[model samples]
Target: MIDLRIRTARPDEATRVLVFWKEAAEGTSVTDDVDGVTRLISRDPEALILAESDGLLVGSVIAGYDGWRCSLYRLAVLPSHRRRGVSRALLEAAERRFAAVGGRRGDAMVLEANEQAHGAWAAAGYRKENHWRRWVKPFAGPSRPV
Candidate 1:
């Protein structure tokens, strides 16, 4: 919808991409940083895709497949462009990317408290598992490098 063109994000798309990620993950600690995101995108290169329409960036998704599992993160569609299937199209593109990388299935980590994200992920064919659990530990001030 809206004549979208989805492709791998370029090196210079950091600012807009940061805004998009912050908005998409509101209340979360995910900050938008051009250099940081650029590095992340450059790491896998093809996993980060951007969606543009009429020459304006409108949506983005970080899709990565590590042979064991296909993961999607930071899916964001600008408020003005929501509900026009922009996000859905971005999701489909990620699915295709996952398939291309030999991923047998797709997976994503939506903040459990974010119902809207859960709904969208479900709509995109992800199911919730009642038996699964996640673990986390926070370092006092800064997280150590993984």
Candidate 2:
């Protein structure tokens, strides 16, 4: 096990976080930019959890709780830090956050093609729900006032 410290991300660290994700994360999302990250931190400071070891950012996990559901995303660890209990520690922190927020169940968005991530998630006791599939529709243009 490594000496790990888990905490919520600070707003100014968004750019650094984005760079880290580019190297550590398996895939990209529509909102994988500085603006998106900044918005996330500004809106829900605790949603983005980061793991550090010896003052170095090593892993991250987004534990977003929208009052009713706990949604996990971007569980990433540096390639050099894999198998070092980083992911486990991150997930534990996320789960603790969920419990504190009255979240009933937690669901993660894992890429189907990332077989390596599948094992990590499974080890953390997250199983796939084959009965349901994620459906997404991306907006190509700017958002309009509702």
Best by lDDT: 2
Any idea how many clashes model 2 has? 0
Candidate 2 yields a Cα-based lDDT of: 0.92
For model 1, residues 38-130, the per-residue Cα lDDT tens digits are 877778888888889998878888898767998887777777887788879989999888878788877676677777778778887889887
Assess candidate 2 and give its TM-score to the true structure: 0.94
| CA displacement after TM-score superposition, residue 2 of candidate 1 (Å) | 2.0
TM-score of each: 0.84, 0.94
Q: What lDDT score goes with residue 18 in model 1?
A: 76
Q: Which ten residues in a row have the lowest lDDT in candidate 1?
A: 137-146
Best by TM-score: 2
Can you list the residue pairs that collide in candidate 1?
none
C-alpha RMSD of each candidate structure in angstroms = 3.0, 3.4
